[model samples]
Target: MKPLVVLVGATASGKTGLSVELAQRLDGEVINGDSMQLYRGMDIGTAKITADETQGVPHHLFDILEVTEEASVVQYQALARQTIAAIRERGKTPILVGGSGLYLRAATDVIEFPPTDPGLRAQIEAELESEGTAVLREQLREADPESAAVIKDARRLVRALEVVRLTGRTFTSFLPQRNHLPSLEPVLQLGMKIERSLLHERIADRVHQMHSTGLLEEVRRLDAAGLRKGRTASAAIGYQQFLRVIDGVLTEEQAVEETIIATRKFARRQETWFRADARITWLDTACEQLIDQALEAVRG
Candidate 1:
């Protein structure tokens, strides 16, 4: 059997296509590591892989939550590891795929996440809204510069601060070190690499395609499903922007542009987050020999 193969990269970096190809070669099933993909009815906005895309390889941990629920990394850690074990039991390889850095690591690494205090988290979140992400990020910088430098958004920034307050330890302490030790078994982590300009083009095109293919409609359906009630699902990149369109605060054109910008920024953050790990073998996303290269990495 093959070792666990993890394909990670920025959004629109072609990780999904590479994943299916790799799974075919490795006789593996794909596991969802993207946090947003776990929610039901979050398909279009998350760019969720369709049944046709899976190409007969089984996928796990997708559409497992309602839009009204929040995603917890701790809960995901348990679910993902269980799924990984089950796949190994069937003698098939497990291909962990997506751009969610922390979730990916939590599945594959020896991370001891600190317990959360909801009251503390709520207070921090309130401060985040009132004082803004800049201020919360500044605090995180003072407390833990490592996490602050890598974290780009308000949500993660708030979590970082919350962990600091709850544990009196730096949030980065929970992050995997450079060694990238796998908790369960050996892992072959592959990061898809692409030129920044090409990635930017891909992001813009994807955002436009999402709008054309009914991202607003998906958001509307989820909105009626209590998307706003869920803290995490409602804040997803495409969904977040389109909700403005749903509110009449922004036109579809403006939402598309904003989604493109936010996605590009999120992609950059993903690149930075994954690049910091030295254990990941980089694969040129555009190369015709990509699958062979990954196989070589697997065998070697």
Candidate 2:
């Protein structure tokens, strides 16, 4: 079986187009590693590739969730591994592409994720809402000092609390996810790098294009589909802003500008996250022979 080839990059860095091109060249199947693209109705905001754009390359793990459903990284890891195996079974290489750093890492790394309990998760989420993340961070500091120090955000903090509460074990005890670890399988990880000014321009242009291309309409449709009920989907950059457009809060113009700013910051965070992993072979997206370079990286 062909070993996996994974692509990492920030939003609007040309990963989608390049993924399709590579799949065409390498006899590979494409898998969606982006967290937002998993939703069926999130196309315009997510820049989901169209069927026409695919040019007949098979894709997986996309459009598999309702807008109301939440996405789980642990579930994605299992499903992605199963998908990679299935693709290999049919004698094809698997090319995973996205800007989601954790999702990509989770899919490739040998992470023994802590167990989950939905009821406990709900209670913890309510505590987060009531007590705020700062207070929860204090509790986590007492419960698991190492994780409390390393884990940065509320989402991971919530999960860490869940693990500590559920099994009476520290989150750090379950897996070595804090650092770049070996993959369970042989794989090549490729990262896309772009000049910062050019990347900002790309993000601004993409968000403007999304605005002109009926992003609000798509969000309206998703709002009707209970997008706000899904914690992850609701907090997604554009959707959250446009759902406000539906609520008469942010005007379309304001939402577009906010989305652009938010996306640029998101791109920076993606850069920071992926840069920590020394395993990835970085590629300049502007290189004339990028596909060739990518192929060489895969083979080398």
Best candidate according to TM-score: 2
**Candidate 1 local Cα displacement, residue 210, angstroms:** 0.9
lDDT of 1 by residue, 40-159 (tens): 999988889999999998999999999899899999999999999999999999999999998999998888888888898899989987888888888999999999889988877888
Q: Model 2 over residues 21-129: C-alpha lDDT tens digits? A: 8898889999999999999989999999999999999999999899889898888998999999999999899999998877887888877777889999999999999
List candidate 1 segments past 4 Å from native. Answer: 119-172, 180-183
**Total clashes for model 1:** 0
User: Each candidate's lDDT (Cα)?
Assistant: 0.90, 0.91
Query: Looking at candidate 1, what is the lDDT of residue 171?
Result: 88
Poorly placed runs, candidate 2 (over 4 Å) = 125-135, 149-156, 172-180
**TM value for model 1:** 0.87
Determine the backbone clash count of candidate 2: 0
User: Any idea what lDDT model 2 has?
Assistant: 0.91
Question: Each model's TM-score, in the order given?
Answer: 0.87, 0.93
In angstroms, give how far residue 178 of model 1 lies from its true place: 3.1
